[model samples]
Target chain A: MFKELNHLDELSRRKFIQYSAKAMLGVGLASTSNNLWGSQIIGKPTAKSVIYIYLSGGMSHIDTFDPKPGWEQQGPVQTINTNVAGIRVSEYLPSLAKRMDKMAIIRSMTSTQGAHEQGTYFMHTSYEQRGTIKHPGLGAWLNTMSGKTNSTLPGNIRIGGSNNAPGGAGFFDSKYEPLHLGDPNNGLPYIKRHQSISEIEMQERLAIAQMMDLSFHQKYPSKKVQAYSDVYDEATRLMRSEDLQAFDLNKEPQSVRARYGDTKFGKGCLLARRLVEHGVRFVEVTHGGWDTHNDNHELVSNLSNPLDQSVSALLDDLHLRGLLEETLVVIGTEFGRSPKINVNSGRDHHPKVFSCVLAGGGIKGGQVYGASDESGHSVAESPVTVPDFNATIAYSLGLPTDKVVYSPSGRPFQVAHKGQALTGLF
Target chain B: MPLSTPQLRSFVFGLALLAGPLASPAEEMAMEEMQMDAMMDSMQMDAMHGMDETSIELFDAAKAVLNSYCYECHGATKQKGDYRLDQKSTIYSPGESEELPVVPGKPDESALFKRITLDIEHDDVMPPPKKARLKEAEIKAIKDWIAAGAIWTDEDVRSGLPTTYVEIGDEATNALIDKINETRAKAEYNAWGDNSVRVDLSVTDKDKLKEAIIGLKDFGTRLAWIDCSYLELSESFYKNISQYQNLERLHLDNSNVSNEDLKALSDLPKLNYLNLYSTKINDDGIAALAACKSLNKVFLGSTKVTKAGVEKLQAANPELTIIYK
Candidate 1:
C-alpha cells in the first residue's frame, strides 16, 4: 500500500512539473527574463561609493536642523543657536548643532506624499509612483553603475532591519539586488557552523547541493536558475571571505561601541561605517518606527535620544578620520508633523513642509538653504522638491543629474528626473 | 554759400550711394511682407504678455494666499508630500492617491483649491492643521484657473522649454578624461579606457593580472589605501614581472628618478613595490604617489620626502611595508 502511494506521488510530481513548464512557456518567460534583467541600465556615479543613513521615520525639521526660536510658543520644542551664526537647531540635537559646519540643512522641503511608503519610495527612486512602472531604488542604481568587485559581500547592503520601501533592483537585473542584513541590532543570523556536522560532512553536503543545482540548471536554463546560481556563488564567497567580520560588532571596542551608543540605531550606524570601510559601495542603515501620528512628542523624545547620539558620533568619527569629505550622510524622514497641536496633543501627517539634513560629500556646510514662516505653517522662501534633494546628493557624490537610464520600451528617464542640483548647498 | 552745379551733382551721387537702390516692384512687395511680419510679431508678443499677466494674477491669487498661510512648511522650500507648488507638474500630479490639485476644466475635482474654501470644522478644510485658511477671493481665482483648463501660461511652463545642451569642448573633455584617469589611478584599478589615458590591460596582460587587479578594486579599497609610492615603479618594467595570476608586483629601490616622471610612474596599476632610498623625491612626489593603489611597500630612507608625507602614506596604506628614517 505504501509503495502504491509513493508511485502516485511521483506521477503527480511529474505532471505538475510538465504543467508548470507548459504554463511558463505560454507566458513567454524568455522575453520576460530579458526585460527583467537588461532593462533600466544606469551608469555608476563618478564617486566610487555612498553611505546612506536613512532616518526611517520622518525626523522633524523644527526639532533638528531648522529651529524657530522666536515662535517658541507656536513651536512645539525649545530652540538653541548652533555654532554657525544665525542657524538654530532644537535643543535635542546639541551635538549635531556643533557639527553644523559639516552639513547643509534644507529647511523648505515640500512633498505631497505624506504617507511613509510613498515618501520612502519617492525619496529612494526619485520617480512619482505610477501603478504601471516600478523604478529602481538609488542603491540598486548605484549597484548597476558600480559593478560589484567582491563576489563575497553584496554591492548594496542594508543594515538594521527590513526597510518598508520596495528597495529591489527594479528594472535592473535582480542580480544587482540589495542584500539585507535583516537586523544588525540582533547578532548575525544563519552564519554559525552546525554543531552536529563535521567539516567533511559539510563539504559533502555542499558538493551534493552543487551537483543537484548544476543538473537542474542544465535541464531548465531560466533566469531564476541564473539568479539561484549567482546567490549560491555569493554565499560560498561570503563563507570564505572577511565578510563575517562585518557582522561581528564585538570586534569594535567597548569605547567605540559606547560612542555610537548601545541602541539599535547606534549599532546599525556603526555597522554601516564598518561595511563602507570594507568596500561595500552602498550601505543603507534604516532606523524605523518613527510614524508618530499620535503622541508624537513622547515618541520623538524617546527616539531622538539614540538618533542624536548615533548621528553625532557617526559625523564626528567620519570627520576625524577625514572620511566626511567623501562620505555623504543624510538624515531625513517621510514628512514633518503638523504644526497645529491636535486634540491628542500630537501632530498629524504634514507633507506640506519639512526638513532634511545633508552633510559631507563636497557640500558647503553650516548653511541653511531655505526657510518656513514664523508660525511654521508654510515655506517662506525657496522650496526644495524630492528630486532636488536626491539630485543634490547625487551631484555632491559626483553623479550627474542629467545622467539618463532607459526603460524596456526605450523611454529615457534621468536618475533624478526634473531636478537641478542645489548649487548653493555645494 | 550757394553750391555749384557739379558740387550739387556730386552730393546727389553720394546721397544715391547712401540709399543704394530704390524699391523695385518685387522689393516693394517684400517691404510690405516685412511690415506684416513685424505687426504679427508685435501682436504675438502682446498675446504672450497678456497670458503671462493672467497666469501671474492667478498664481498670486492662488499661491500667495495658500503658500503664505499653508505652504510656509509645505511649499517648494519644504515639500512635505514630495509635492511642491514650486513646480507645475508636482502641483498637478500631487501624490499617488489624491486627485489632481487643480483639475483642468473642473473645479469640483480640484481637491487642493476646494480644501482651502472649506470651513474650519470641515474635514476637507484647507490648511487643515496649520495657521490659517485661504480667503474667499483667493479660492475664486484658483477656481478660475481650473475653469480655464488649469492652464499654466507663465514663461516658466515646464513643458516645451528648450533644454540648453552645452557641447563639451576638446579641452574640457580632455580635462575630464585626465580627472577620471587620476581618480582611477588613485582607486588602484587597472585603467579601463573610456575617454581617459588609454591603458588597455586586456592585451598587455595575457596571464590576467589586470582582471585580478580589477576584481580586488572595490569601494573598500578606496577607504583602505591612500598613497602612490606603490605606483613609483614604471609600467614597462612591471608589465613583464608577473607572479600572481591577477597582479604584477614591482620593486624599484634606490632608482634614479626625478619628480617630473612621477605622473608616469603613478599611472601604472601593476606596480607593487618601490624603494626610493636616498633619492631626490619630495612631498610633491609623495602627493603623486597617493593615487597609486598597487604600491604595497615603500623604502624612503635618506630622501627629500618629508616626515609628513611618510606619515600620510602610512595612514593611507596601513598594510604597506614602509622603510624610512
Candidate 2:
C-alpha cells in the first residue's frame, strides 16, 4: 500500500542508484494500491483541507506582517499594535491587526528564485524552475496522497487566473490535476447541462465515449492512458451530484457577502470557505495586483483592504463553522518587496527575505516564528527556505514530506524536495 | 565570493544547499531509510500496544506486524488459498494447505515462521517475490513473540483502531468503538499515532443522529471529539454524551440545541471546544461554557447569546477565542 517503503531487497543503495531509472521507478509499483492500505488510516487525520491564499506579485514584508517602524524602509504606512500583545502590523491592515491572536506570523522566509515566474513557481512547487521538467504543485501532491474527503467534488479547485508555473499535475495522472475556475463570480462554469442536452442525451454521449476509450485503452495500457477514463467518470459524477452547490456563491446571505466585500479576491475567499466545508481537499485563491513597482504606498495600502477584510472574515467564518480546527488557512506569496524604496518611490523585488502567516489546523497562534533583520534586509534568525516553509505546511496536514514519488520518466520527487518541516510550529 | 580552488567552489555550493539548522543533510537523508521502512512498519505495529512499557508493547506489535503483512490477502477482502490471519481463532489452526501456519511457543514448528525465515530466492518465502521480504527486525519481533506464548488479544487489529494508549483497549471502549462503526457515524482516531477515537454523529436524518449519540453510554476515557452538528438534538442526547469525562471538542453547530443543553455539558470537565453556531442558546449557555474552566474556544455566531454574555466569558478568560458574527 505504501510505495515509499517497499524497495528493500538484495539491491544495495549504491547499486540501486546506478541501476537504470525505469528499473527503480516502475519495477514493483503495481503490486500495491489504495484498496490494500488506504482503508485503514493508522493515524487520525489532521488538517483535512487547506485554503492557500496566494498574494501574487511580491508582498512587502516591511509594509505588512513584519513592520519596521523606526527604519527609513518603513514608509508612510504606520505600524499598529495587534490584539496580541507586542505583535504589530501595517496601519492599512487594521482589521487583520485586530484578529492577530489567530495568526502565527513567520518573518524570516527566504527564497533563491527572484524573477516573478520563477519565484511564483518555486513558492508553489518547492522546486527551482528547470526547463527539462515541470514540478507538481502542493494541491496535486495532497490529492495524490489523500483522495478528497468528498468524492463528488473535485479534489482541488484553483480560483484565479494566476500563472501556470505551478506546473499542473507534473508527471502525475490527469485525474490528480486541479479544476481551474476562471472567475469567482461565475461560480463553476460549464458545470450544469446547457439546457439543450437532455439527461438521456448526456448518458448516450458518455456510453459512446467509453466504447471508443476501450479500444484506445487496449492500444495503450499505460497508467496515463487509463487516467483519461477516470477523468470522464469524475466529470460525469460531478455534474450529476447534488452537492455542486458548494461552489455557488448565491447561497450566501447578503450580510455575509458584504462582510467579505464585493471584490473578486473577497469573493474568491468566500468561495474557498464554501468549498472547504463541502470537503474539497485543497483550494487556492490568488489575488493579483501586488506588483506595486510605482506607487508602493498607495497601491499596497489599497490592496491590503480587500486582503484584510476578506481574510479576517474567512478566519471568523471558518471558526464559527467549527472547520478551523481541521482546516489550515495559509497566506503565501512569491517573495517580498525590497526594503529600500526604489527611484520610483516603489519597492523592487527582494527575494532575500519575506513574511508569511498561518492559522488554525493545530498551529499555536498568537506567536511569531523566525525574524528578519532590523531593516528587513536579511534573515536574522530561524532562516526558513522556500522548501522548508512548504514542507511545514505539508507537515501540518500530516503528510510525509520525505516520501519519494517518482515522476513518469523515473525521476524521484517529494512533496517538498529535501525540505525539513518546522515541527515546532505545531 | 571567493572562488579559489575548484574543490572549494563545489564545497561552497553544497553548503548553500543545506539550509536552516540542517548542517548535515547527507547523514539524515532517506538513503539510510531504504531498508528502515520494514523496521519502522513493525515498530508502528508495536506502537499500537501503547505507552512506554516495552515488552507487552512488543507482543501487540508482533501481532500488528503479522496483520500488516498477512491481512491484505487473508482479512476482510480476499481469502487467498483458503487461509485467513484476520481472526485470533484462525491463525493457530491449519489452512486449506493442511499445514499449521502457527504453533504456540514454537517458532521452528510453525510453517508461517519457517516461510518468513526462508531464503529470499526460494519460492517458499512467505510474501513471495511480488511483495518485499521481511527485514531482520520484523522477523525477530515475530520470532520473539512465538518464543513466548504468542497470546493474541481479542481486541488487536479488530476495527482497524490503533490502540496507542493501553487503557483505551478496555472492554467498554472497545464496545463503544464497534457501536460507532456499525452506526456509520464515522468514529476515528482523534489524532494520528494516538489511540483515542472521536465520533462524528453528523449524519442526515436528525432522529438517526440523535439515536447514534444517545445509543452509546459510558464511552470510557478515550473519547475525544463528538460532532453532533446540524441536528435537532434531544435533552437525552446531551445528558448521555456529557458522561464522557475526557471529551475535548464538541460540535453542536446549526442545531436546535437550547441553553438547557449547555447545562448538560457541565459534567464534561475536560471539554475544550464548543460550537454553538446558529443555535438558539442565550447568555445562560455562554455562562455554562464559561463555568467549564478548561474551555479553549467557543462559537456563538448567529446564536441568541448577547454581546454582554461573550464579554463576560472573554473578560474572565483572556485565552479563549470567543468566536461571534
Candidate 3:
C-alpha cells in the first residue's frame, strides 16, 4: 500500500517524496485509472499538465536543434551524437543528447515577427501584437478550457518571469493572470502569519478587512474591484491548504536536488515539476540571457550546460515518477539566432527559421520534424509558424483549438490564431 | 493583380482622359495640364501589369466576412468537422464527405450561405449559440462574393493608393464645389475656414454624374470628404479624384469603385476614411492599400471578399479597422 502525507507538520524536509509517495504517484495512477494499467491508449491524450520552459532572448537554432557542422555559419561548434540513432546536438548538451528519445525537435520553426516582443507574443498566442486588443496567452486559454487542477493553487505559475514577458490572461479576467514567482527557493511569500497572531485572530482580521471594503466594492462593482477580492480569497485558500507544501522545494532530497544542478533555472525546473505533481496545470519557467549578440559560443556553452542537465533530469525524473505520460514538456524561445556570424562573433535575431522541442504528453520521441536549409538561413521543408507551434502544444492537451472566444472588445480570438496543429508529431 | 495603387490610379486617369478629352485642352496645353497628362500616361503604363479590378474587389469582400465570422471555427488553427475556410483550395473544394461549404458562382447552392441565412433558431445556423451573430450586411457580402465566382487569388490590396497635390485657383475651386452641390452633392467647407471641404454626394442624381466629375477638380487638395455612394463612379472619376492630395475621407460605397479606382486613392496620404461598401473591390485592391499608411479604417459592407482576403488585410495592417456592417 502506498503512503500518503496527510499533514506537513509530521514530515521532515528530507522525507518529502518518501512520505508523500502516494500523493505524487497516486494522482497519476488515479487519473490514468480509466486506461488499463500498462496499456497504451493510442489517439487518447495523456497530458493533463504542461511544463513550458521558455528560453527567453533567442536561442540559436544552428547551435541547438538544427546543427550545420560543415557550414561556415555554424562557426567552430562541434556536434555530438544522441542516443537516438540519427539525432545530434551541440557538444555542450551531452546530457540532453543522451535523453533525446524523450524529445521531438522541430528544426523549421518559423515566424514573420523578428523583434523579441512581437516574436514572443506571436509564439505564446499565435497572433501578432496589436494595439487595439490584448489576446489571452495559452496558459489562460488552457485554464478556461480545462479548469483548475488544485483548488488552492492558481492554474498557471511563472517562475523568474519579467515585466516584459507576454501578457498573461490578457482578455481573460485578472484572476487568470499567472501567479508570478521571482525565486523558486523562496517559495510563496506572506503565507505564514506573525508569531503573535493566532489562526482565529488572522481570520478575524481578514473578516474585518472584507467588511471595511464591502461598501467600496458595492459602489465600484468593477472588474478591478472583483479581481482585488479574488486575490484575497485565493491567497487565503492557498495559505490554508496543505498542498502549498509543493512550493517548498527544500523538502526535496539532496541527491534529487543535485541532479537538477544548482543554477536558478535548474531550481525553477525542479519547482515546476513539483507544482505539476501538486496538480498545477501550467507552469512557465523562464531562463533569460540567451540573446547572445556577442561571445555567442562562450555564452551558449555556459547556458547549455545547466539546461542540458536540468532538462534531461526533468525528463528522467518525470518518467521515473510515471508523470511523463501526463505532463507535456516544451522548450521554446521567441526565435533563433541567425546562422551568419557577425563582426562581434555573435549572431543576430533570425525569425525566418528556428526550433523548439516537445516531449512526453502524446508526442512521439526520438524524432526531428522539419528542416532548415544547408546554410540554416531559411526553412527548406515543413516550415512551422508560431501559431502552428502553439496549436501543436494545445493539441497535446486535447484542448479544442477551433473554439473562438471573444475578448471583452467582442473581437474573436482562437487558441492558436490561424495556425494549424502539426499533428504529425504524434 | 500585383499592380500598385498608383499605377492603377494612373491607368484609370489615362483612360478617363482618353474617353473625354480634358474639359479644356489644346495641342499646346498649359504646363500643369501637360504634367498631369504625363503622370496619367505613366500610371496607365503601370496598370497594364495589374490584376483585373472587378475580380479583386469581389475577393476582398468575401474574405472579410469569412475572417470575421467563420475563421475562428474553420480557420488554420481549428477546423471543426474537418472543414477549413482559411485556404482557397479547401474552401472552394470539399475535403470531407459532407456537402461543399462554398460553391463558386452559386451562393444559393453553397452550404455556407445556406447555414448562415438559416433562421436563428435552426440547429444548423452558423455561429450557433454563444457565438456572435453575423450581421445582415456581412452575410450579403459573402453571398455576393460567391455569386461573383468566389475568386480566391493570393493578392494583398491594403498597400493603398498614392496622393498627388496640385494648386488650383479660388475661382476654379468655387466652380467645382458649386457644380458638385448642383448635383445634390452636399459640399461643405471646413469649420476652420481652411481650403478643406466635405463633399457628400450620397444623394446625388446618377444621371448628372458627369457634372459632379467636372466639379470635383476645383476642390483638389481642399477636398476632405466625398461620399459618392451609388454614383457608379467610372475610371475618369477615380483619375480626376487622385489629384486631391489632402483628401482624408472618401465614401464610394455601392459605387463602381473597382480595384482600378482603389489604386487612385493611395496617392492621398492624408486619407484615413474610406467606404467601399457594395463596390467591386477585392483582396488585391485592399492589398494595394497596405501602402497607404494613413488609412486605418475601411467599410466594405455588401461586397465580394473571402476569408483569405480578410487575413491578408489583417496581416498587412493589424490596426486597420475594417467594417462590414
lDDT of 1 by residue, A305-331 (tens): 888889888987665433455567877
- For every model in order, the fraction of real contacts preserved is 0.00, 0.20, 0.00
Ranking by TM-score: 2, 1, 3
Off by over 4 Å in 1: A1-46, A72-76, A198-200, A213-222, A407-412, B1-325
Candidate 2: tens digits of C-alpha lDDT, residues A1-426: 224324433223223332432352322321123211122232334577899999989999899999999897688989989999999888988998988888889999999988999998899898888775678888878777654555468878899965354846765555667888879899888888769879888777667656644644454343433454565677777887656888899999999999999999999999999898766879999988888899899999999999999999999898777788788899999899998998898998998999999988877788899999999999999999999998888887766665555443334567787688777878
**Candidates ranked by lDDT, best first?**
2, 3, 1
Highest DockQ scorer: 2
After superposition, the stretches of candidate 2 with alpha carbons farther than 4 Å from their true spots are A1-46, A163-167, A211-222, B1-191, B195-247, B255-271, B280-296, B306-325
> What DockQ does every candidate get?
0.01, 0.09, 0.01
Candidate 2 collision pairs: B46-B61
Q: What is the per-candidate TM-score for chain B?
A: 0.31, 0.45, 0.44
Candidate number with the higher lDDT (1 or 2): 2
- Per TM-score, the best of the predicted structures is 2
Residue-level error in angstroms, candidate 3, position A320: 0.2
Candidate 3: tens digits of C-alpha lDDT, residues A1-426: 012222222213114432232342221111212111111111234476899999989998898777899787788789999999988888988998988898999999999999989988888878788875577788887776555555577788999969447858876766678988999999988687768989899788677666665654554343433555566788877777766788999989999899999989999999999898766889999988889999898888888888899998899877655467668999999999988888999999999999899999868899999999988899999899888998888878766565444343223456787578889888
Tell me the TM-score that candidate 1 gets on chain A alone. Answer: 0.83
* Per-model TM-score versus the true fold: 0.56, 0.65, 0.53
- Judged by DockQ cut-offs, is candidate 3 incorrect, acceptable, medium or high? incorrect
